[model samples]
Target: MPESWFVPTIAAPRRPIGRQVFDFDRQIVVMAIVNRTPDSFFDGGRTYGLESAVAAALAAAEAGAGWVDIGGVPFSPDTPDVAVADEIERVVPVVEAVTAVSDVVVSVDTWRADVAAACLAAGASVVNDTSGLRDPELAAVVAVSEATLVITHSRAEPHVHLRAPRYDDVVTEVRAFLAERIEHAVGLGVPESRIVIDPGHDLNKNTLHSLDLTRRFAEIAALGLPTLAAVSNKDFVGEATGLAKPDRLAPSIAAAAVCALAGARILRMHDVAASVAAATMIECILGFREPAFLAHNV
Candidate 1:
């Protein structure tokens, strides 16, 4: 039987993003992915155009996502290096358009400090640096803007494929990597209240490694900051179930439930509705959330 886990109290104060503040202690946030890159692995650039991207953001907000993460660059190592100007062009408009229409917290997914700054100026509230702080300038930007910073764990440098990355113990290595990055961000003036950690499932890990991280996620959350599980249609899910990307929603949600049970506070998801349902049900089971109508009992 899977061990029943409890949601540990996150004593950190609410993180402010633009005009929005997230109290991870009380809320299990669903951050919907709104990828504007034409080559993003999952979406295949379906929302690459400005209008399509804006519409996608609105749709995610309406579908019950508390946060929307807009990414202009594909994180896949095969993706070409997008110029800072090109990234700014792709992301800032979406951020501005989304922020203008919805009150949802907006996070810009980029490792470049200039692009992050441009997005923040355009109304984004968080910088999701999936490169694990490859550039310290990204941290400085977040510090100066007083915005939220998502420090992810990735062994390879940005846009560089690491062939067959191995670890003695994946969870321990990931935990240590995230800890070091978090400390580095704080030392660079990013506050603890504004920090979030991600194990970067499938970023550099194999399927088994990702499974280990999911099983031992509480160790990552033990850092006392909200941890994000980006388990939406990732390769690990496909590898685990022998399913393709288009057919991995159910398994993805199942993995997300495990992460939630292990005390993950934020879910970075592609399928917003399903992930919201899974996280909500897990929260209710853990007594972190209450049922809305109570029809069956009442």
Candidate 2:
């Protein structure tokens, strides 16, 4: 267990998502996945259309997710490249619709600057750069907008498969990479509070590497900044438990529990309801959140 947990001082000034501000110190933000791509590994394009995507976002909010990460492209190299205009087309309407109807924070999962700018304009409160800022200009767009930036660590460019990438120390390297990117984003005028770091578990790492990062997640949280764990149905979790994508929810929630115990503040997941329940339990255990109704236990 960590000596100190949920340190609010490490987060940026309250991050505004429309009218709501997320206080990372007191909240475990559940960012529900809403992939607009037809080829997403998890959903198989279930929310590919505008209406379905908007519905998905609203449903997640209803299920207790504080944020919805809408992505128009998959990071796998096997997935085809989406044109900037088409990417914008796929996400903007969803962003606009979700923001219009729900108070949940909307985050656009894109590595393209143009697509990011358009989504931010459409009312996304965050830009989740899964490619590790492959497009240098993406940071500038986030810097200028009221949106926050999620800088993840990926060893290769978007869509390129990383075959057994080596690292002297996986945790140390991820921490260093995220630190540099955070500094770079701040240098570009993004406030430190408006920035969050993700170690990019399966984004560029193998099963063992992701497991190590999750186990040593306390080190990442020690940076005193909000860290995001996007472990929902990821290959690492599947590989670890021999579960397929649809059946990985149990292990996914288990990994999320470990992440929460290690002090990770954000959990990006596909099963919003289950993740919220698990996170709520973890939060209560950590004393960061109290039980809904204290009865006999009190």
Candidate 3:
């Protein structure tokens, strides 16, 4: 590996999110995704029920996930709007159930302020907003609660699509957007230590743009905050490897490893166990973790 590939890891910091402290300088955190939306692009209603969503989150925690991100709606364009009440109903129960039983950090993936406030009251500690804070009130909610805010970079509204999104430089633009959003959130009384950034792979960008962001992910990591990479079973992974969503696990793991090596502290993944293994291997290679029972050639 080139020396440049490891530069960003040197700047990773210890970030305290909610009740857990993530030492990004020495470990990688896997954030399992559990969408409660019936129209989720990945699961397609598999865990939409309250029981199923909670079960899936617990399973992910058991599988070595440090965090579980529960969402009530998909960001795909043309998906029907889920009313704020309905969205809260869909996600809050899962958050309440998971946090009541497990030590895993629970995050609600919504951009609406009301839903975020409800989830925080339900015991969730992080707000994973993928809309780039289109609703500024969400920042105030996070600030008032003193929970972690994941500011993801996306160019479109929640249910609206941007046709043919273009960026002069994807990584640079993403870094600038995240920096601005971090400042915006901090201005609203959100502590700077409680903010995370995501480049929003495939959220509004095409495969080429997403790939570029992944290739240059270290630039985003260098922003000196805990960076998140949500590259699990996304359209960019599918398009890059010419595989359908169901068949993209290997490529998704590959992408996760790449991002981990490039200084992504948090990986939001659907396949919890497999992604955990990949993250562990990267940690061992980077000298941040010791191999478990290394007897093969010891």
Candidate 4:
């Protein structure tokens, strides 16, 4: 049992998790983030070109990424036009290239319906939306594709959203936001099987709020849907470790390990290789593997 939160419906009928939205058939799958933008906070512009994007995707697959989330724009509300076609052009090639080569699931990271549709057409299995289904069209896309729709909770984008972020209780606020978004998407025809929840971290968030949410990942898991945690080497890591952006590897690994133990199903990470290693260690310690270590050089 989790100390932070408890299951609301203790007697609620159980649903087999084998074929859930994110598919818990496997243990602690990693979702590597291949940001194809010029300013995606971390690892931006690293996969700008088609070759680099393809290489990045292949690398993630090689690093044991159960899924790779290919993102284009940085999701900044202040950003200019960014037409649907441009977003597709930026991510479609990567999607096609990666999906063509790897059997691992590929999730498209975008908020626009058109972009998500195009990426799906190009071969994306899930839609990772950061706006919490604020866009009706995004709901429509998810409804039609029935793709795993990851809805993240965020307050009114204080600066660009024409409203301020006022939260008497951030945890309750985020949970309510995701609940509403899930209802909205299901109302538009997306099944419960297609919904996944992510508690937004770092993006438009203060350090304390991020820490609280990270520590309370069990509460997010209590939502009954697969939880995808996107906390890979963001400012929150720096806040906790006082490490610069380049030195966030340890904090990122620690955060991902904690989330995995707390029931995070998907880890959206920048360091797929290191995170995979960390997740494997956590799995071993969690009694998922035999407690034995052969001679492997440190």
* Clashing residue pairs for model 2: 12-193, 77-159
lDDT of 1 by residue, 29-101 (tens): 8999999988989979999999999999999889889899999989887888889999999999999999997
Candidate 1 vs 4: which has more TM-score? 1
Order of models, best TM-score first: 3, 1, 2, 4
TM-score of each: 0.96, 0.95, 0.96, 0.87
Give me the overall lDDT of model 3.
0.89
For residues 1-298, could you state the per-residue lDDT of candidate 2 as single tens digits?
A: 3553333345463566656777667678899999999999888999998899989899999999998999998888888888889899999999999999888888999888999899998888899998877677998898888888899999897888888899889999998988888888888888887888899988879888999999888888878788899998899988899888879999999998888778788999999999999888877886777789968956
lDDT scores in order: 0.88, 0.86, 0.89, 0.76
Over 21-92, each residue of candidate 3 has an lDDT whose tens digit, in order, gives 889888899999999989999889999988899999999999999999999988887689889999998998
Relative to the unseen true structure, what is the C-alpha lDDT of residue 256 in candidate 4, on a scale of 0 to 100? 78
Off by over 4 Å in 3: 2-4, 7-12
The alpha-carbon lDDT assigned to residue 29 of candidate 3 equals: 94
- Write the number of the candidate with greater lDDT, choosing between 3 and 4: 3
Between prediction 1 and prediction 3, the one with superior lDDT is: 3
**What TM-score does candidate 1 get on C-alpha atoms?**
0.96
Residues 165-208 of candidate 4: C-alpha lDDT, one tens digit per residue: 45677777788888888888899988887677899886557777
Candidate 3 at residue 272, lDDT? 92
Best by lDDT: 3
